[model samples]
Target: MKKERCDAASGVESIELDATVVATIRFKAVPPQLLEVDIALCDAAAAGQVDMYNSTPLFVAATGGCTGAVDTLLKHGAEISCSVLYETCHYGQAEAVAILLDHGAKVFANTGQQNPMCAAARPGSVKILELLHECGFDINPSDQGMISTPLHEASEIGYVAVVEWLLTHGANVDATDGAGKTSLHHAVNRRHSDVVTSLLDHGAQADIQDTVRSYRASRGKYDIVQLLLANVSNTQRNLTVTS
Candidate 1:
């Protein structure tokens, strides 16, 4: 009987299932093809050196965007712990994310990356973000880490499309992260002109609307603040001209 990896003796994490099997799973292999890797869907951690994820075959499948393999693993009770969903979102595997969600995966994963929303934002996965919203994820989850919301993450990386989508879906345009910086602040600091424009379209960007907050900028580049004030001036001028 081919036992699942979870059946291994208590707390053993080193690769139980062969790395080759995991590699196969990572490269888009599905069902019957997955037959050789143990039907039990092991919980073995195939550390980075070997499988590059230090996670289970399920996680490997998720990161690889192998939807069928992920479904197979979930059917066998593979653990969808924090890391699993987080890694899946980080990789922008929407189909796999849907599978995990259907399998009772948590909407807001609290992995090393904090929220899966941030992970998806890093890659500009708007489809995955939509899936997250459908599953009831908070559009503006408070940044318990580097970014306050997915919008901040998108703007920080200059994911212009993602920034626009997040705004349309109710993310606070002026929301701040732990650094007390809004999406506009991040966009301005990162020189993401397109993202700056997107944020301006949403609402007030703290460009000069009485925001008592800190700035995440180098002392040498305090000029970025001036640039923001200058942008606000341009916007006001445009608005006046249009009126």
Candidate 2:
């Protein structure tokens, strides 16, 4: 679904833009002057020229970590679409994301790139999430009609570092998506023991009932019910001691 939505930014403008320019950027070429020669190419599409499946020159440069092209394009008035940020996150390009944000790129949730924070979390780097945070993107980005917070994405994919980072950075451990299931529920269903432990340690409600989906233990190696009960016991003991 994410790939489909992100790919929606794709289209080609062969007459207005140079194929050589797109190729150079795609292959890691970084001379900014190649762009200066053709200022028309910078914002050829008004919205932002995209080729190779709807990628902007700025976005291509950022994706490949080519700072020069990124700078040149932005200076020439390239569109600062959130789609660029989304691609940078999806590609794990932290510096590129910072460049876009520095150029005043805001996450327009209504765009095709609906959930940039989700893309950041999907890449398994807390740094990208941190960059977005600088842009005022909270731990849980506001829903754009799509389900799953960044926490849910990381939890389902079993990225414990991402899960922990979100929890520390202001994620609601008990927050549910449109599906009415918390990140904890996702982890349990996906059988990510490490992620489940991280969520529980972060004070997720272990006793919260699962109303969306249920799963049976396929193998004895990991027991969901046992894990939840164990956390519940530890929580009660901690409360009693502190009381």
lDDT (Cα, tens digit) per residue for candidate 1, span 33-148? 55434434444242221454565677776777767667766775576776688778888888998898888876454433467787789889998888877877777776455557
Best by TM-score: 2
Q: Which number leads on lDDT?
A: 2
lDDT of 2 by residue, 1-243 (tens): 001112234564322454555655566455555543443344434226565666766777787776665776787678776667777888888877878888887655334446778888888989988877777776675446467788998998999999998898889888898878888888887888788889988988876645112324314434665667576656554553354
- For every candidate in turn, the CA RMSD to the true structure comes to 7.9, 9.3
For model 1, how big is the CA root-mean-square deviation?
Answer: 7.9
TM-score of 1: 0.69
Candidate 2 residue 169 C-alpha distance from true site, Å: 1.6
lDDT score for residue 110 of model 1: 40
Native-to-model Cα distance after best TM-score fit, residue 46 in candidate 1, in Å: 12
Candidate 1 has which clashing residue pairs, if any? 5-42, 143-148
lDDT of each: 0.67, 0.69
In model 1, how large is the Cα lDDT of residue 94? 89
